[model samples]
Target: MAEAYLLEEVSNFTTKYYADNLPSVHNPPPRYNVAENESSLSLFQGQLGSASGATSKFLAYEEWRTIMLYVLTNLKETMSYIEEFIHQFWRRSRDPTSNEIDTLLKQGAGSGKPDFISWFKKKIDLTEVFGMEVDNEDARDEVDDAKDLQILERLHLDSDDDIPPPSDNLHDYVDMHDIDDETHEPAIIDDDDYF
Candidate 1:
Protein backbone atom coordinates (compact mmCIF):
# COMPACT_ATOMS: atom_id res chain seq x y z
CA MET A 1 0.00 0.00 0.00
CA ALA A 2 2.87 2.38 0.79
CA GLU A 3 4.55 1.54 -2.51
CA ALA A 4 1.27 2.24 -4.33
CA TYR A 5 0.89 5.60 -2.60
CA LEU A 6 4.54 6.47 -3.37
CA LEU A 7 4.04 5.60 -7.07
CA GLU A 8 0.86 7.74 -7.14
CA GLU A 9 2.73 10.68 -5.63
CA VAL A 10 5.54 10.26 -8.16
CA SER A 11 3.01 10.19 -11.03
CA ASN A 12 1.26 13.31 -9.72
CA PHE A 13 4.56 15.16 -9.25
CA THR A 14 5.74 14.29 -12.76
CA THR A 15 2.46 15.35 -14.42
CA LYS A 16 2.17 18.56 -12.38
CA TYR A 17 5.79 19.49 -13.06
CA TYR A 18 5.29 18.91 -16.81
CA ALA A 19 2.04 20.90 -16.93
CA ASP A 20 3.57 23.80 -14.96
CA ASN A 21 6.68 24.10 -17.18
CA LEU A 22 5.24 23.20 -20.59
CA PRO A 23 6.91 25.39 -23.28
CA SER A 24 3.64 25.88 -25.17
CA VAL A 25 2.02 27.50 -22.10
CA HIS A 26 4.14 30.70 -22.65
CA ASN A 27 6.59 32.10 -20.07
CA PRO A 28 6.20 29.33 -17.44
CA PRO A 29 7.89 29.65 -14.05
CA PRO A 30 10.70 27.40 -12.78
CA ARG A 31 9.78 23.67 -12.48
CA TYR A 32 10.30 23.17 -8.71
CA ASN A 33 10.14 24.80 -5.31
CA VAL A 34 12.85 22.72 -3.61
CA ALA A 35 12.15 24.03 -0.10
CA GLU A 36 8.48 23.08 -0.34
CA ASN A 37 8.61 19.86 -2.40
CA GLU A 38 11.91 18.28 -1.28
CA SER A 39 11.39 18.92 2.43
CA SER A 40 7.81 17.63 2.20
CA LEU A 41 9.07 14.43 0.53
CA SER A 42 11.84 13.93 3.08
CA LEU A 43 9.33 14.38 5.90
CA PHE A 44 7.06 11.86 4.21
CA GLN A 45 9.93 9.35 3.92
CA GLY A 46 10.81 9.80 7.61
CA GLN A 47 7.18 9.31 8.65
CA LEU A 48 6.85 6.21 6.44
CA GLY A 49 10.06 4.70 7.89
CA SER A 50 9.01 5.33 11.49
CA ALA A 51 5.48 4.02 10.92
CA SER A 52 6.66 0.82 9.21
CA GLY A 53 9.69 0.32 11.48
CA ALA A 54 11.75 0.16 8.32
CA THR A 55 15.50 -0.49 8.65
CA SER A 56 16.31 0.38 5.00
CA LYS A 57 17.80 3.86 4.77
CA PHE A 58 15.93 6.39 2.67
CA LEU A 59 17.80 8.31 -0.07
CA ALA A 60 19.91 11.18 1.30
CA TYR A 61 18.53 14.72 0.89
CA GLU A 62 21.11 15.65 -1.76
CA GLU A 63 20.40 12.45 -3.73
CA TRP A 64 16.67 13.05 -3.60
CA ARG A 65 17.14 16.69 -4.65
CA THR A 66 19.27 15.63 -7.62
CA ILE A 67 16.65 13.09 -8.72
CA MET A 68 13.77 15.60 -8.46
CA LEU A 69 15.76 18.16 -10.44
CA TYR A 70 16.57 15.60 -13.14
CA VAL A 71 12.93 14.56 -13.40
CA LEU A 72 11.76 18.18 -13.47
CA THR A 73 14.30 19.07 -16.18
CA ASN A 74 12.91 16.37 -18.48
CA LEU A 75 9.34 16.44 -17.16
CA LYS A 76 7.34 16.88 -20.37
CA GLU A 77 9.19 14.32 -22.47
CA THR A 78 9.51 11.99 -19.50
CA MET A 79 5.73 12.05 -18.89
CA SER A 80 5.07 11.29 -22.56
CA TYR A 81 7.52 8.37 -22.40
CA ILE A 82 5.88 7.07 -19.21
CA GLU A 83 2.39 7.25 -20.75
CA GLU A 84 3.54 5.30 -23.81
CA PHE A 85 5.37 2.77 -21.64
CA ILE A 86 2.23 2.12 -19.54
CA HIS A 87 0.13 1.55 -22.67
CA GLN A 88 2.74 -0.83 -24.10
CA PHE A 89 2.98 -2.71 -20.81
CA TRP A 90 -0.81 -3.23 -20.59
CA ARG A 91 -0.98 -4.29 -24.27
CA ARG A 92 1.72 -6.90 -23.62
CA SER A 93 -0.02 -8.10 -20.47
CA ARG A 94 -3.37 -8.81 -22.14
CA ASP A 95 -4.27 -10.34 -25.48
CA PRO A 96 -4.39 -7.51 -28.03
CA THR A 97 -6.98 -9.42 -30.13
CA SER A 98 -9.29 -10.39 -27.23
CA ASN A 99 -13.02 -10.62 -28.07
CA GLU A 100 -14.04 -11.27 -24.45
CA ILE A 101 -14.86 -7.54 -24.35
CA ASP A 102 -17.27 -7.85 -27.27
CA THR A 103 -19.04 -10.82 -25.69
CA LEU A 104 -19.36 -8.96 -22.39
CA LEU A 105 -20.99 -5.86 -23.89
CA LYS A 106 -23.30 -6.99 -26.71
CA GLN A 107 -26.40 -5.22 -25.28
CA GLY A 108 -25.01 -1.69 -25.03
CA ALA A 109 -26.48 1.23 -26.95
CA GLY A 110 -25.48 3.63 -29.84
CA SER A 111 -22.54 1.65 -31.17
CA GLY A 112 -21.53 -1.82 -32.38
CA LYS A 113 -19.76 -2.58 -29.06
CA PRO A 114 -18.73 -0.99 -25.77
CA ASP A 115 -15.04 -0.20 -25.13
CA PHE A 116 -12.92 -2.05 -22.60
CA ILE A 117 -13.34 0.59 -19.85
CA SER A 118 -17.15 0.53 -20.06
CA TRP A 119 -17.15 -3.26 -20.07
CA PHE A 120 -14.81 -3.20 -17.07
CA LYS A 121 -17.12 -0.79 -15.15
CA LYS A 122 -20.07 -3.12 -15.81
CA LYS A 123 -18.02 -6.05 -14.52
CA ILE A 124 -17.17 -4.05 -11.38
CA ASP A 125 -20.82 -3.28 -10.76
CA LEU A 126 -21.86 -6.93 -11.25
CA THR A 127 -24.28 -5.94 -14.02
CA GLU A 128 -24.69 -6.36 -17.77
CA VAL A 129 -24.49 -3.36 -20.11
CA PHE A 130 -28.32 -3.12 -20.39
CA GLY A 131 -28.87 -3.42 -16.60
CA MET A 132 -29.46 -7.19 -16.57
CA GLU A 133 -28.34 -9.21 -13.53
CA VAL A 134 -25.18 -11.33 -13.46
CA ASP A 135 -25.75 -15.05 -13.96
CA ASN A 136 -24.11 -16.30 -10.73
CA GLU A 137 -26.03 -14.06 -8.30
CA ASP A 138 -26.60 -16.66 -5.54
CA ALA A 139 -23.05 -17.96 -5.92
CA ARG A 140 -21.82 -14.81 -4.13
CA ASP A 141 -23.54 -15.78 -0.84
CA GLU A 142 -21.51 -17.28 2.02
CA VAL A 143 -21.72 -21.08 2.28
CA ASP A 144 -24.12 -22.31 4.97
CA ASP A 145 -23.01 -24.76 7.67
CA ALA A 146 -24.68 -27.73 5.87
CA LYS A 147 -22.87 -26.87 2.63
CA ASP A 148 -19.60 -26.50 4.56
CA LEU A 149 -20.11 -29.93 6.13
CA GLN A 150 -20.82 -31.40 2.67
CA ILE A 151 -17.58 -29.92 1.34
CA LEU A 152 -15.65 -31.27 4.36
CA GLU A 153 -17.10 -34.72 3.78
CA ARG A 154 -16.22 -34.59 0.07
CA LEU A 155 -12.64 -33.66 1.00
CA HIS A 156 -12.41 -36.33 3.73
CA LEU A 157 -11.73 -33.56 6.25
CA ASP A 158 -14.04 -34.86 9.06
CA SER A 159 -11.93 -37.86 10.12
CA ASP A 160 -8.55 -38.23 11.80
CA ASP A 161 -8.93 -42.04 11.42
CA ASP A 162 -6.64 -42.00 8.36
CA ILE A 163 -3.67 -40.81 10.43
CA PRO A 164 -1.34 -43.53 11.84
CA PRO A 165 -1.16 -43.66 15.68
CA PRO A 166 2.26 -43.41 17.35
CA SER A 167 3.81 -46.89 17.77
CA ASP A 168 4.01 -48.28 21.37
CA ASN A 169 7.29 -49.99 20.34
CA LEU A 170 9.06 -46.61 19.82
CA HIS A 171 10.82 -47.16 23.20
CA ASP A 172 12.25 -50.46 21.85
CA TYR A 173 14.68 -48.53 19.61
CA VAL A 174 15.81 -45.94 22.26
CA ASP A 175 17.41 -46.96 25.63
CA MET A 176 15.59 -45.08 28.46
CA HIS A 177 16.60 -47.44 31.38
CA ASP A 178 19.55 -45.28 32.59
CA ILE A 179 17.40 -42.24 33.49
CA ASP A 180 16.23 -42.18 37.14
CA ASP A 181 12.46 -41.39 37.37
CA GLU A 182 13.05 -40.07 40.93
CA THR A 183 14.89 -37.02 39.45
CA HIS A 184 11.48 -35.53 38.46
CA GLU A 185 10.01 -35.77 42.04
CA PRO A 186 7.83 -32.78 43.04
CA ALA A 187 9.58 -30.31 45.33
CA ILE A 188 8.26 -30.18 48.94
CA ILE A 189 6.90 -26.62 49.43
CA ASP A 190 6.19 -25.05 52.81
CA ASP A 191 2.86 -23.20 52.54
CA ASP A 192 3.48 -21.65 55.99
CA ASP A 193 6.52 -19.74 54.62
CA TYR A 194 4.29 -17.90 52.00
CA PHE A 195 1.70 -17.10 54.73
Candidate 2:
Protein backbone atom coordinates (compact mmCIF):
# COMPACT_ATOMS: atom_id res chain seq x y z
CA MET A 1 0.00 0.00 0.00
CA ALA A 2 2.83 2.38 0.81
CA GLU A 3 4.47 1.63 -2.53
CA ALA A 4 1.19 2.35 -4.31
CA TYR A 5 0.82 5.60 -2.35
CA LEU A 6 4.36 6.65 -3.24
CA LEU A 7 3.76 5.95 -6.91
CA GLU A 8 0.51 7.93 -6.77
CA GLU A 9 2.33 10.86 -5.18
CA VAL A 10 5.02 10.80 -7.85
CA SER A 11 2.42 10.56 -10.62
CA ASN A 12 0.38 13.41 -9.14
CA PHE A 13 3.47 15.61 -8.83
CA THR A 14 4.46 14.88 -12.44
CA THR A 15 0.95 15.67 -13.68
CA LYS A 16 0.73 18.95 -11.75
CA TYR A 17 4.20 20.02 -12.90
CA TYR A 18 3.33 19.44 -16.54
CA ALA A 19 -0.06 21.08 -16.22
CA ASP A 20 1.38 24.21 -14.58
CA ASN A 21 4.37 24.56 -16.88
CA LEU A 22 3.93 23.96 -20.58
CA PRO A 23 6.95 23.15 -22.76
CA SER A 24 8.27 25.88 -25.08
CA VAL A 25 11.33 26.60 -27.25
CA HIS A 26 11.58 30.16 -25.92
CA ASN A 27 11.31 29.43 -22.18
CA PRO A 28 13.93 27.55 -20.14
CA PRO A 29 13.16 24.21 -18.40
CA PRO A 30 11.05 24.53 -15.24
CA ARG A 31 13.19 25.39 -12.25
CA TYR A 32 12.69 23.54 -9.00
CA ASN A 33 10.68 25.51 -6.45
CA VAL A 34 11.20 25.56 -2.65
CA ALA A 35 7.44 25.38 -2.01
CA GLU A 36 7.05 22.40 -4.32
CA ASN A 37 10.00 20.68 -2.70
CA GLU A 38 8.49 21.22 0.73
CA SER A 39 5.14 19.92 -0.46
CA SER A 40 6.76 16.76 -1.85
CA LEU A 41 8.72 16.22 1.35
CA SER A 42 5.57 16.69 3.39
CA LEU A 43 3.94 13.80 1.57
CA PHE A 44 6.59 11.40 2.89
CA GLN A 45 6.54 12.60 6.52
CA GLY A 46 7.78 9.63 8.57
CA GLN A 47 9.04 7.69 5.54
CA LEU A 48 12.16 9.84 5.02
CA GLY A 49 14.91 9.17 7.57
CA SER A 50 18.67 9.19 8.23
CA ALA A 51 21.03 6.22 8.67
CA SER A 52 24.07 8.06 10.07
CA GLY A 53 23.46 6.70 13.59
CA ALA A 54 23.51 3.03 14.64
CA THR A 55 19.74 3.01 14.26
CA SER A 56 17.72 4.95 11.65
CA LYS A 57 16.63 8.42 12.77
CA PHE A 58 14.33 11.12 11.36
CA LEU A 59 16.17 13.42 8.99
CA ALA A 60 17.27 16.88 10.04
CA TYR A 61 16.22 19.96 8.00
CA GLU A 62 19.38 20.02 5.86
CA GLU A 63 19.29 16.27 5.39
CA TRP A 64 15.62 16.35 4.52
CA ARG A 65 16.14 19.14 1.98
CA THR A 66 19.03 17.25 0.38
CA ILE A 67 17.00 14.03 0.23
CA MET A 68 13.98 15.86 -1.18
CA LEU A 69 16.19 17.36 -3.90
CA TYR A 70 17.47 13.91 -4.83
CA VAL A 71 13.95 12.51 -4.84
CA LEU A 72 12.65 15.36 -7.04
CA THR A 73 15.52 14.94 -9.49
CA ASN A 74 14.86 11.22 -9.83
CA LEU A 75 11.11 11.82 -10.06
CA LYS A 76 11.62 14.29 -12.90
CA GLU A 77 13.88 11.87 -14.77
CA THR A 78 11.37 9.01 -14.30
CA MET A 79 8.56 11.26 -15.53
CA SER A 80 10.58 12.06 -18.67
CA TYR A 81 11.02 8.35 -19.39
CA ILE A 82 7.25 7.80 -18.93
CA GLU A 83 6.42 10.74 -21.23
CA GLU A 84 8.77 9.40 -23.91
CA PHE A 85 7.15 5.95 -23.67
CA ILE A 86 3.65 7.45 -23.99
CA HIS A 87 4.68 9.51 -27.03
CA GLN A 88 6.22 6.43 -28.63
CA PHE A 89 3.08 4.39 -27.94
CA TRP A 90 0.89 7.13 -29.46
CA ARG A 91 3.04 7.32 -32.60
CA ARG A 92 3.08 3.56 -32.99
CA SER A 93 -0.67 3.17 -32.48
CA ARG A 94 -1.38 5.83 -35.14
CA ASP A 95 0.55 3.88 -37.79
CA PRO A 96 -1.38 0.78 -38.93
CA THR A 97 1.68 -0.90 -40.47
CA SER A 98 3.89 -0.42 -37.41
CA ASN A 99 5.00 -3.72 -35.95
CA GLU A 100 7.29 -2.18 -33.34
CA ILE A 101 4.66 -2.68 -30.63
CA ASP A 102 4.29 -6.36 -31.55
CA THR A 103 8.02 -6.77 -31.01
CA LEU A 104 7.51 -5.91 -27.34
CA LEU A 105 5.25 -8.97 -27.15
CA LYS A 106 7.52 -11.30 -29.14
CA GLN A 107 9.16 -14.33 -27.47
CA GLY A 108 12.86 -14.27 -26.35
CA ALA A 109 14.90 -11.05 -26.10
CA GLY A 110 12.98 -7.80 -25.39
CA SER A 111 9.72 -9.69 -24.91
CA GLY A 112 7.87 -8.30 -21.89
CA LYS A 113 5.38 -5.41 -22.16
CA PRO A 114 6.66 -1.91 -21.38
CA ASP A 115 5.54 -1.52 -17.76
CA PHE A 116 6.29 1.80 -16.05
CA ILE A 117 6.07 0.26 -12.57
CA SER A 118 8.80 -2.22 -13.41
CA TRP A 119 10.78 0.53 -15.10
CA PHE A 120 10.54 2.61 -11.92
CA LYS A 121 11.78 -0.34 -9.87
CA LYS A 122 14.76 -0.74 -12.20
CA LYS A 123 15.59 2.97 -12.45
CA ILE A 124 15.08 3.81 -8.78
CA ASP A 125 15.58 1.17 -6.13
CA LEU A 126 12.94 2.09 -3.54
CA THR A 127 15.00 0.58 -0.72
CA GLU A 128 17.98 2.84 -1.45
CA VAL A 129 15.96 5.91 -2.48
CA PHE A 130 13.70 5.91 0.58
CA GLY A 131 16.45 4.66 2.97
CA MET A 132 14.21 1.72 3.97
CA GLU A 133 13.91 -1.95 3.21
CA VAL A 134 11.22 -2.70 0.59
CA ASP A 135 9.40 -6.04 0.25
CA ASN A 136 9.31 -6.91 -3.45
CA GLU A 137 7.34 -10.11 -2.74
CA ASP A 138 4.19 -8.04 -2.38
CA ALA A 139 4.68 -6.69 -5.88
CA ARG A 140 5.17 -10.18 -7.24
CA ASP A 141 1.99 -11.38 -5.55
CA GLU A 142 0.00 -8.51 -7.12
CA VAL A 143 1.32 -9.44 -10.55
CA ASP A 144 0.37 -13.08 -9.98
CA ASP A 145 -3.15 -12.08 -9.01
CA ALA A 146 -3.51 -10.00 -12.20
CA LYS A 147 -2.30 -12.92 -14.35
CA ASP A 148 -4.77 -15.22 -12.60
CA LEU A 149 -7.65 -12.86 -13.37
CA GLN A 150 -6.64 -12.69 -17.04
CA ILE A 151 -6.46 -16.47 -17.27
CA LEU A 152 -9.90 -16.79 -15.71
CA GLU A 153 -11.29 -14.25 -18.17
CA ARG A 154 -9.83 -16.18 -21.13
CA LEU A 155 -11.24 -19.44 -19.82
CA HIS A 156 -14.69 -17.86 -19.45
CA LEU A 157 -14.62 -16.54 -23.03
CA ASP A 158 -13.58 -19.94 -24.45
CA SER A 159 -16.21 -21.99 -22.57
CA ASP A 160 -19.85 -22.43 -23.66
CA ASP A 161 -21.10 -23.50 -20.19
CA ASP A 162 -22.43 -20.03 -19.45
CA ILE A 163 -24.78 -20.11 -22.46
CA PRO A 164 -28.32 -21.38 -21.67
CA PRO A 165 -29.59 -24.64 -23.28
CA PRO A 166 -32.23 -24.50 -26.03
CA SER A 167 -35.85 -24.68 -24.75
CA ASP A 168 -37.84 -27.93 -25.40
CA ASN A 169 -41.36 -26.47 -24.65
CA LEU A 170 -43.86 -26.55 -27.60
CA HIS A 171 -44.99 -22.92 -26.96
CA ASP A 172 -41.46 -21.71 -27.56
CA TYR A 173 -41.61 -22.89 -31.24
CA VAL A 174 -43.49 -20.89 -33.92
CA ASP A 175 -44.62 -22.06 -37.39
CA MET A 176 -43.89 -19.72 -40.31
CA HIS A 177 -46.76 -21.01 -42.56
CA ASP A 178 -49.45 -20.03 -40.01
CA ILE A 179 -48.56 -16.31 -40.34
CA ASP A 180 -49.98 -14.01 -43.11
CA ASP A 181 -47.37 -13.17 -45.80
CA GLU A 182 -48.46 -9.52 -46.17
CA THR A 183 -49.02 -8.18 -42.64
CA HIS A 184 -46.97 -10.90 -40.92
CA GLU A 185 -49.91 -11.62 -38.54
CA PRO A 186 -51.43 -15.07 -37.77
CA ALA A 187 -53.95 -16.07 -40.58
CA ILE A 188 -57.61 -16.21 -39.43
CA ILE A 189 -58.88 -19.80 -39.93
CA ASP A 190 -62.53 -20.24 -41.09
CA ASP A 191 -64.08 -23.66 -40.15
CA ASP A 192 -66.85 -23.32 -42.88
CA ASP A 193 -64.25 -22.86 -45.70
CA TYR A 194 -62.34 -25.93 -44.47
CA PHE A 195 -65.57 -28.06 -44.32
Candidate 3:
Protein backbone atom coordinates (compact mmCIF):
# COMPACT_ATOMS: atom_id res chain seq x y z
CA MET A 1 0.00 0.00 0.00
CA ALA A 2 2.80 2.40 0.90
CA GLU A 3 4.68 1.43 -2.26
CA ALA A 4 1.64 2.05 -4.43
CA TYR A 5 1.07 5.40 -2.75
CA LEU A 6 4.67 6.39 -3.45
CA LEU A 7 4.63 5.18 -7.10
CA GLU A 8 4.36 7.51 -10.14
CA GLU A 9 1.24 5.78 -11.65
CA VAL A 10 -1.09 6.35 -8.65
CA SER A 11 -2.18 10.01 -8.45
CA ASN A 12 -0.80 11.60 -5.28
CA PHE A 13 -4.29 12.87 -4.42
CA THR A 14 -5.90 9.39 -4.68
CA THR A 15 -3.14 7.83 -2.56
CA LYS A 16 -3.72 10.58 -0.05
CA TYR A 17 -7.45 9.86 -0.34
CA TYR A 18 -7.09 6.18 0.78
CA ALA A 19 -4.40 7.05 3.31
CA ASP A 20 -6.81 9.57 4.83
CA ASN A 21 -9.80 7.22 5.16
CA LEU A 22 -9.09 3.57 6.29
CA PRO A 23 -9.21 4.26 10.07
CA SER A 24 -13.01 4.92 9.96
CA VAL A 25 -13.49 1.26 9.01
CA HIS A 26 -11.14 -0.34 11.58
CA ASN A 27 -10.00 1.92 14.43
CA PRO A 28 -11.96 1.92 17.69
CA PRO A 29 -11.35 4.65 20.25
CA PRO A 30 -9.04 4.38 23.23
CA ARG A 31 -9.16 1.03 25.00
CA TYR A 32 -6.57 -0.02 27.61
CA ASN A 33 -6.22 3.59 28.82
CA VAL A 34 -3.69 4.38 26.12
CA ALA A 35 -2.41 7.80 27.07
CA GLU A 36 -1.12 10.02 24.25
CA ASN A 37 2.21 10.20 25.99
CA GLU A 38 3.47 6.73 27.00
CA SER A 39 5.70 8.16 29.72
CA SER A 40 9.16 9.49 28.91
CA LEU A 41 12.39 7.53 28.54
CA SER A 42 15.76 8.71 29.79
CA LEU A 43 19.09 8.84 27.94
CA PHE A 44 22.61 9.14 29.26
CA GLN A 45 26.00 9.38 27.60
CA GLY A 46 28.98 7.44 28.96
CA GLN A 47 32.00 5.60 27.57
CA LEU A 48 29.72 2.61 26.91
CA GLY A 49 26.33 4.36 26.65
CA SER A 50 26.73 6.27 23.39
CA ALA A 51 23.66 7.43 21.42
CA SER A 52 23.00 5.43 18.25
CA GLY A 53 24.20 7.03 14.97
CA ALA A 54 25.86 9.81 16.95
CA THR A 55 29.26 10.84 15.64
CA SER A 56 32.27 12.64 17.24
CA LYS A 57 30.30 15.90 16.77
CA PHE A 58 27.82 14.71 19.45
CA LEU A 59 27.90 16.27 22.92
CA ALA A 60 27.35 14.78 26.42
CA TYR A 61 23.79 16.18 26.44
CA GLU A 62 20.69 16.75 24.17
CA GLU A 63 18.34 14.42 26.15
CA TRP A 64 14.74 14.19 24.76
CA ARG A 65 15.43 17.04 22.34
CA THR A 66 17.90 14.89 20.40
CA ILE A 67 15.24 12.32 19.38
CA MET A 68 12.41 14.83 19.08
CA LEU A 69 13.05 15.40 15.33
CA TYR A 70 12.79 11.70 14.47
CA VAL A 71 9.97 11.11 16.96
CA LEU A 72 7.86 14.07 15.85
CA THR A 73 8.37 13.40 12.12
CA ASN A 74 7.34 9.76 12.53
CA LEU A 75 4.36 10.70 14.75
CA LYS A 76 3.19 13.35 12.32
CA GLU A 77 3.40 10.94 9.37
CA THR A 78 1.55 8.21 11.27
CA MET A 79 -1.23 10.48 12.64
CA SER A 80 -1.78 12.17 9.26
CA TYR A 81 -2.14 8.75 7.63
CA ILE A 82 -4.63 7.62 10.30
CA GLU A 83 -6.84 10.74 10.03
CA GLU A 84 -6.65 10.73 6.25
CA PHE A 85 -7.70 7.06 6.23
CA ILE A 86 -10.65 7.74 8.51
CA HIS A 87 -11.82 10.62 6.29
CA GLN A 88 -11.48 8.54 3.12
CA PHE A 89 -13.44 5.61 4.61
CA TRP A 90 -16.17 7.92 5.82
CA ARG A 91 -16.39 9.36 2.31
CA ARG A 92 -16.78 5.86 0.80
CA SER A 93 -19.40 4.42 3.24
CA ARG A 94 -21.88 7.27 3.55
CA ASP A 95 -24.53 8.67 1.15
CA PRO A 96 -22.77 11.52 -0.70
CA THR A 97 -25.69 13.96 -0.04
CA SER A 98 -25.90 13.09 3.69
CA ASN A 99 -23.58 15.02 5.99
CA GLU A 100 -23.54 12.13 8.54
CA ILE A 101 -20.69 9.59 8.57
CA ASP A 102 -21.10 5.78 8.35
CA THR A 103 -18.54 4.81 10.94
CA LEU A 104 -18.03 1.32 12.46
CA LEU A 105 -17.92 2.09 16.17
CA LYS A 106 -17.49 -1.04 18.32
CA GLN A 107 -17.99 -1.93 22.00
CA GLY A 108 -16.62 -4.70 24.18
CA ALA A 109 -17.76 -8.17 23.02
CA GLY A 110 -18.65 -9.16 26.65
CA SER A 111 -16.14 -11.68 28.03
CA GLY A 112 -18.87 -13.88 29.57
CA LYS A 113 -19.17 -17.46 28.25
CA PRO A 114 -15.46 -18.14 27.96
CA ASP A 115 -14.84 -16.63 31.40
CA PHE A 116 -17.63 -18.70 32.99
CA ILE A 117 -16.33 -21.90 31.37
CA SER A 118 -12.82 -21.17 32.54
CA TRP A 119 -14.04 -20.41 36.06
CA PHE A 120 -16.13 -23.61 36.16
CA LYS A 121 -13.18 -25.64 34.91
CA LYS A 122 -10.93 -24.16 37.58
CA LYS A 123 -13.54 -24.80 40.29
CA ILE A 124 -13.96 -28.42 39.21
CA ASP A 125 -10.15 -28.90 39.01
CA LEU A 126 -10.32 -30.76 35.71
CA THR A 127 -7.59 -30.11 33.11
CA GLU A 128 -5.11 -27.24 32.90
CA VAL A 129 -2.84 -26.20 30.06
CA PHE A 130 -0.16 -27.55 32.36
CA GLY A 131 -2.23 -30.69 32.98
CA MET A 132 -3.65 -31.47 36.45
CA GLU A 133 -1.60 -33.83 38.67
CA VAL A 134 -3.44 -37.19 38.58
CA ASP A 135 -1.89 -38.71 41.71
CA ASN A 136 -4.36 -39.56 44.53
CA GLU A 137 -2.61 -39.18 47.92
CA ASP A 138 -5.42 -40.99 49.80
CA ALA A 139 -5.18 -43.96 47.40
CA ARG A 140 -1.42 -44.16 47.99
CA ASP A 141 -1.94 -44.14 51.76
CA GLU A 142 -4.51 -47.00 51.47
CA VAL A 143 -2.05 -49.03 49.36
CA ASP A 144 0.69 -48.49 51.94
CA ASP A 145 -1.69 -49.57 54.75
CA ALA A 146 -2.65 -52.79 52.86
CA LYS A 147 1.02 -53.66 52.29
CA ASP A 148 1.80 -53.08 56.00
CA LEU A 149 -1.11 -55.38 57.01
CA GLN A 150 0.14 -58.10 54.62
CA ILE A 151 3.70 -57.88 56.08
CA LEU A 152 2.33 -58.08 59.67
CA GLU A 153 0.16 -61.10 58.77
CA ARG A 154 3.16 -62.88 57.19
CA LEU A 155 5.18 -62.44 60.45
CA HIS A 156 2.55 -64.46 62.41
CA LEU A 157 2.87 -62.81 65.86
CA ASP A 158 0.71 -64.49 68.51
CA SER A 159 -1.33 -62.50 71.07
CA ASP A 160 1.05 -63.85 73.81
CA ASP A 161 4.28 -63.15 71.87
CA ASP A 162 7.21 -61.77 73.90
CA ILE A 163 10.08 -59.67 72.47
CA PRO A 164 13.73 -59.72 73.65
CA PRO A 165 15.16 -56.72 75.47
CA PRO A 166 17.58 -54.38 73.62
CA SER A 167 21.33 -54.73 74.43
CA ASP A 168 22.19 -50.95 74.34
CA ASN A 169 22.11 -49.86 78.04
CA LEU A 170 19.66 -46.95 77.56
CA HIS A 171 19.26 -46.01 81.28
CA ASP A 172 21.81 -48.48 82.76
CA TYR A 173 24.63 -45.94 82.19
CA VAL A 174 23.92 -42.23 82.39
CA ASP A 175 26.08 -39.58 80.62
CA MET A 176 29.12 -39.67 83.00
CA HIS A 177 31.01 -36.66 84.29
CA ASP A 178 33.59 -35.19 81.89
CA ILE A 179 36.70 -35.93 83.98
CA ASP A 180 40.30 -37.14 83.88
CA ASP A 181 40.86 -40.91 84.40
CA GLU A 182 42.10 -40.19 87.94
CA THR A 183 39.41 -37.63 88.93
CA HIS A 184 35.71 -37.50 88.10
CA GLU A 185 33.75 -34.21 88.15
CA PRO A 186 31.32 -32.47 85.83
CA ALA A 187 32.99 -29.88 83.57
CA ILE A 188 31.84 -26.46 84.83
CA ILE A 189 31.41 -23.20 82.87
CA ASP A 190 33.07 -20.11 84.26
CA ASP A 191 30.12 -17.75 84.70
CA ASP A 192 28.87 -15.04 87.09
CA ASP A 193 26.60 -17.57 88.82
CA TYR A 194 28.43 -19.84 91.33
CA PHE A 195 27.35 -23.47 90.58
Specify the highest-TM-score model's number: 2
Colliding residue pairs in candidate 3: 19-85, 20-84, 20-85, 21-84, 21-85, 21-86, 21-88, 21-89, 22-85
- Find the candidate with the highest lDDT and give its number: 2
Reference-based TM-score of each model: 0.13, 0.18, 0.12
Cα lDDT tens digits, model 1, 8-116, are 7786666645644353334333354222234433223322222344476699965864555354334453344333323423434565333432322222223333322
The global Cα lDDT (0 to 1) of model 1 is 0.38
Local accuracy of candidate 3 as per-residue lDDT tens digits, 58-101: 54434433344235324533344334333433435543332231
lDDT of each: 0.38, 0.42, 0.33
CA lDDT, candidate 2, residue 121: 45
Model 2 C-alpha lDDT per residue in residues 3-73, reported as the tens digit of each score: 99998778656664464445433333445321223444334543344435576689996586556435643
The lDDT, on a scale of 0 to 1, for candidate 3 is: 0.33
How does residue 110 of candidate 1 score in lDDT?
A: 31
lDDT of 2 at 29: 43
State the TM-score for model 2.
0.18
Clashing residue pairs in candidate 2 (N, C-alpha, C atoms within 3 angstroms): none
Which regions of candidate 1 are displaced past 4 Å? 1-58, 61-74, 91-195
Q: By summed lDDT, which 10 consecutive residues of candidate 3 come out lowest?
A: 101-110
Q: What range of 10 consecutive residues in model 2 has the weakest lDDT sum?
A: 101-110
